[model samples]
Target: MSYQSIHIQIKEMIFSKDVSIVEFQFWLAEVETFLCQQQNFVLVVRSVAGTTFPQEYRQIQANWYKKNKANFFKYCVGLVRIALDQVDQERLNTPALHVAWQVPYYVTLDRADALQWAVQRWLLCNA
Candidate 1:
């Protein structure tokens, strides 16, 4: 399956896909560029694929964060995670929240919850 990335406005960004590491990195770079223009923005991520905790993937994320943490925190107001089920949600959210503790994170089982949480966060941050 293919991945999609769209900026709904200055308020939010959406990334939905079952992406490979390469695709994820490309999308991430695009998102980062968008975030750089904002004071704060809500980030919504929908992982349509099932969760798989590969060490390589985790390492890549960690390394990317290490290299870009300041820019990341400077613009990220909150995060919304959309997972297929409880197990996937927990598996993805746990580590992500650990790394991005400065931002509020909402984990949801469906797209509607994800969008609701993200919109609320965007409102709060912009307010």
Candidate 2:
């Protein structure tokens, strides 16, 4: 299936997809672009049940982040809102496990909870 990546005015980065390695790489670059421009924001990812990336894709991501970790550390705040369901515990943990970048990440079962958590984190930091 396809993916959707969108940047809202609130400075949150959101993406929903079931993509291949190549598509994931492209999507990640778009995320990097947003992080670079926004400088610091929360990320919201919506994933389907049973979705998992190949080990090779995970390796590629790890390598890319190893090269760009400093940039992410410099510009990003490191909070992730993952939207998934309890039925897919494995998929729910995939992002947190695969991410090479250092940041406080979280997973939620729904978009509303994810958004609320992200916003609360934002408010806590800004306050």
Candidate 3:
């Protein structure tokens, strides 16, 4: 399947679902490349119904990270969008990593009053 055709889930960052173990590794690898190639961006990933990495795909990622640590940046935002009918706990528990070369300075907009809380921060501060 074409990456262009794929739509990842996005709340803040964009994300996609992994249907299987092989697909899960492929997804991570692709995301890693996207972050390395892009200068500034946020990645959105929804934790799957199972522990994708820790239980199934972590070793693959570990090997990749071991060799390309410099090419990627790890940010643990600890963000989770929960749903009752869905959302697997084991999958959520699996460690999630967001790779980015740079982070942007921004303000938090209140969900109820977006503009009221929205304010842009200086990028220099982030750097």
Candidate 4:
């Protein structure tokens, strides 16, 4: 399934374009729905090299994550974020932000590394 700038696969979400607030909300809803199934999954978010969002979008995501913290902990094994652009790579490399996610979070410029990290987490969780 797919929203405006987000494409959803069984265990991955690809953000191929810059997302608007509406699109972000849609993606959030899809995530919430997925969590409702109560299954363990690794979420791999691949953002296009230059994709970015406004501060408001971050605020919305923060609020939603806060509200669903427990469900996320129970269902999400980890999160792997692939950001190819230098700016995005630096921004996502923060230790504090990684801790704030409350899940294993990894950021990398290489999609292969992201997938490998995600698969490792998935294996650990499902083991």
Q: Write the per-residue lDDT of candidate 3 for residues 1-127, one digit (tens) a residue.
A: 5554422212243234435677766666665665565433233334323433436566776777667555544431122323222234343333331122232222222222222212112122224
The C-alpha local distance difference test score for the whole of candidate 3 amounts to 0.38
Residue 95, model 4, lDDT: 88
TM-scores for candidates 1 onward, in order: 0.70, 0.65, 0.40, 0.80
Candidate 1 lDDT by residue in tens digits, 1-127: 4996544433333444444678657756865774677556677776545433334676777777787778777777677767778887788678656566567777788777777877777677666
Candidate 4: tens digits of C-alpha lDDT, residues 38-79: 777788888665677756997898899989999998888888
Q: In model 1, which regions exceed 4 Å deviation?
A: 1-18, 50-55, 93-100
Regarding lDDT, does 2 or 3 come out ahead? 2
Ordered by lDDT, highest first, the candidates read 4, 1, 2, 3
- Give lDDT tens digits, candidate 2, residues 1-127: 4996543322344434445787778867866885567555566666555566655886888787887777767555545545555655455566556464466667666677777877766555544
- Model 2 residue 8 lDDT? 35
Candidate number that wins on TM-score, 2 or 4: 4
CA shift of 70, model 3, Å:
1.5
lDDT of all predictions: 0.66, 0.62, 0.38, 0.79
lDDT of 4: 0.79
**Residue 109 shift from truth in candidate 4, angstroms:** 1.4
In terms of lDDT, the best-performing candidate is 4
